[model samples]
Target: MKHGFKQRLFIVAGILLVVCAAVWLVISAISDNMRYFVSPSEIQAGIAPEGHTLRVGGLVVAGSVRRIAKGLTVRFEVTDNASTIPVVYTGILPDLFREGQGVVATGKLRADGIFVAGEVLAKHDENYMPREVQEALNKAEGAVDVGNAMRKSAGGSL
Candidate 1:
């Protein structure tokens, strides 16, 4: 009876250990694979990871958007008033995607610094701005006097 009880206890402990290990692995995986979105200036300032997948958003640079092969593939540049990143997308772009419109793309950066976008998302209107970009712009425009240098550009207020 003592031997049987000891064996059952050992089996339970082993199962518990396995479960704990599995949970830990799952949590680690989720944390590692989670990606975030950033703007062009953020990328230029070295705020984003070099090799991880991320979303980049900005206005489609004026006169820089071109359609290739009946709207199947499009090439454009997203500019955040400071820097621009070239983007290539092989899927149907959102209807709001156009010259000087806001856009967001998700993908990894290529060796040549171009963004190879897997998905292209666009905003509905000219006034559309990401929350982070809006705040950055407001602060940069001296809407708040925080000692940060004000930056103004032709592509938009921010």
Candidate 2:
């Protein structure tokens, strides 16, 4: 009876260890794949992880979009009123991807200060701004409060 009990205990211990290991592996994998959102100001302040896939969102700077030599590649600058980051994308832009609009780009930042975007997300619905981008822009410019900004952009009274 003693021998049987000891064997059972050992089996239970092994099972528990395997379960713990699996959980740890899952958590680590999720963390490695997760992408964080940051504003242009945060990136300029060195808060974003360099060369790691992350999201930077802000308003597209007016008259900053430039076509690169008649190719699909285009360069533009995004700003949160406090700081700006140059972005390069080689694909067709969304119809709503115009100047002074909120935009989010997912990619890694280059050492030369250019954000090489793998994907660019533009405002979809009418008078819609991503919550994160709107908050960041509001924070950057105190004179332009959140309500005022939204109203001004939407061309409606708040």
Return the top candidate by lDDT.
2
TM-score to native of every candidate shown: 0.72, 0.76
Model 1 Cα lDDT, one tens digit per residue, 30-128: 987787877777676677777888888766777787778786788888876567788999987787666666667899887677888999877664445
TM-score of 1: 0.72
Superposed model 2: Cα runs more than 4 Å off: 1-10, 142-158
Candidate 2's residue-wise lDDT over 1-158, tens digit each? 99999999999999999999999999999988889888888888888899689988887776789999988999999888788899999999998887767799999999888999989999886467788888788778443654454445445533
Whole-model lDDT values for every prediction:
0.71, 0.83
* Model 2 residue 15 distance off true place after TM-score fit, in angstroms: 1.8
